[model samples]
Target: MKRFTLRTGIRWKITIAIAAVGALITLALSLVVHSAARVSMLESARETQLDRVQYISRNAEAGRKPPMGAKLNDPELPQELRDKARSGRRGTYVQEKPRGLPEVWAAVPLGNGQVLSLHSQFRESANMMRDLDRALAIGSLAVVIGGSALGVLIGGQISRRLRQAAAAAGKVALGDPDVRVRDAVGGVVRDETDDLARAVDAMADALQQRLEAERRVTADIAHELRTPVTGLLTAAELLPPGRPTELVRDRAQAMRVLVEDVLEVARLDSASERAELQDVALGEFVARRVSALMPEASVRIVADEIVSTDPRRLERILGNLLANAGRYGKPPVQVDVEGRVVRVRDHGPGFPEALLREGPSRFRTGSTDRAGVGHGLGLTIAEGQARVLGARLTFRNVAGPGGTDREGAAAGAVAVLWLPEHAPTTTGSFPVIGVP
Candidate 1:
């Protein structure tokens, strides 16, 4: 196994720095004490040597200096004492005579100036210095090791909390919006994590509100539209045969038209509708519908327009425009299509100015002639379908083509559908239709 090393964070590193400094200071203090103690012991030993020499001088003859000048650093001493005197003890030192060890002579001084003395023993200063060094080394090492351990423990605690916060943030990024850091261990990240959680919660609440609103609207359309349709079916079943088949047929046809138009509008408003788009050359598509419905109405495909849409739905929208036009416009009803745009302008009295901005509204009549024949749902349904197909249905009162008698007071109604220029789709042409 590898040896463990201490690592620290910002806060703990500062603590460790302080601890290390304290350890160093403690070691320095120990060295100071060791030095002082050694100095004091040497001073005491020196005083003892002087006292011994003075006592010997008073008792016997002596000189101003010792006969040997200084024999404490004698090479013939024990190996341990020899190294200590030169390397450990740097100042004045004294050696004591060992009894019965050779002819060792004790130091004694003459009264005036002559000196006589010889000593052979070990230096105590050497032993004291070694003891001080050993004790200091052990104490200093313990202090440093303990301080470093504490610093690492503090750093580890901070690192763990930071890692937890990062893990929670990562989970949120992976689409687990519900994930969040716990609030129990409050710190710098507390406010920030709380803010993030609240933001996600708010987003979820908004999504649910939007979904509920859509469901409610769908339910409302189903309830309102189904009642009229049921009554119309029953009324049709009770219609007695004969009595001018024309009137009966027209009446039944009128009811059918109203029901179909309302249902188309409802489908457009339904959130579940998805338009199956396809590549369509709009020129041929519009021309076919126009020719089939109004062969003698002088229909014209004015441009080689192209788009992606439900061709059947487009036909229905144009069929509604043509029916409105044929009922109210001049004999030659006109149909024109441009690039991604289908325009049907009639040569009859124009639509009522009041309903121009209302685009597709229920029972909004554009004329009085067709009032009894059908409710004003034709334009509304067409506009709704055009929107669902990713397009806009616009109404405008404009002069007839060439602005001449062909208009024949033919300023009836002009409806234009601007379709989305979708990219080419792989689906087949003329798929099942859906309102926009």
Candidate 2:
């Protein structure tokens, strides 16, 4: 059997804690006040009994006796008080009953060998004490209830503000750079929560400004290099066909490819690229594109589905994935299309741990070869294009039969792309073909 418990949110927990503390303090104060009042009232009753006894003793000494209703010399006097009178010592004692008011007895000795007693019933004082106790009990209960209600109200307000700030932070984490906690939590009275919201807003602003600056610099650099790269390409193409000429042509072509890749990356970073979606059969599109770009790779269409997406961007994403598989992986690169999802699997040693963790970056290579690794812009451009089409791209290392590393671990790299079934299209599409 599972143990039962009371589960509560922060609001209730805070409210209960504050109310409990208030209740304890109120109870302590009430007890102290009640005790002090009881002591003072009891002392006053004792003094009144003492005064009555003194007056009766004086009258007896003047040869007069207490009046009939005074209860002086009553037969019901306690033995302790009677004995003190017989010994000629003045004394007082209290007499108690089970269900009624108590009586105070005072005794004194007469000069003629007789004892005198005086007593007073404490009916009025006992009733007053009972009423006082009732009031204290009711007042203590009221204080506890009122304090708890106030605590709940204050705690609810605080909890609501905190939840608003948390939601804004969640949106910020999900790439909504414009989300701000200040709008939700800001108020005229500045508090710690407001300070936290302001700090979050300031951090987001700084991050956005830095990113914009970096994008502008990248775009400007790419634009300046394009002219010189074009001239170099033309000169290399005009050279005579020879060993040295071939080397120059190849190097110039590589440089041109790099320049174009940089321009494409800059365009993506600046959000200048848009998708031009069209209704197309996904299976036929994948087959034709794979045949045209990577004829050596095997293609399998599991279940076809009509999807609305940018055909050119789709081709770029698939082409880059295929090229990376062929470059870094063994033969038999497999392309599988199921519904709106595509899976490209390469039976290689799998992606390096760093590449999987950090995604892709320009000019960073993960190939084991020390030389001739292409600038690492293929996956970077592919991922950026996927984002433009509102698609998701994920990479993982899967276990494959007979494919193992030197340590005898089976592994292969799998890149999966998921396109939305009904993607919205715009007027323009970004072309990423031949980008390095």
RMSD (Å) of each candidate, 1 decimal: 20.1, 7.9
* Candidate 1 error regions (>4 Å): 1-240, 244-250, 366-373, 399-410, 423-436
lDDT of 1 by residue, 295-334 (tens): 8766566678667787777888889888877875555577
Clashing pairs in 2: none
Residue-level error in angstroms, candidate 1, position 89 = 90
lDDT (Cα, 0-100) at 178 in candidate 2: 62
Pick the TM-score winner.
2
lDDT agreement of model 2 with the native: 0.81
**Number of the top-ranking candidate, with lDDT as the measure:** 2
Tens digit of per-residue lDDT, candidate 2, span 124-204: 887888898888888888887888888787777777888999999887654566679989875566678888899988988
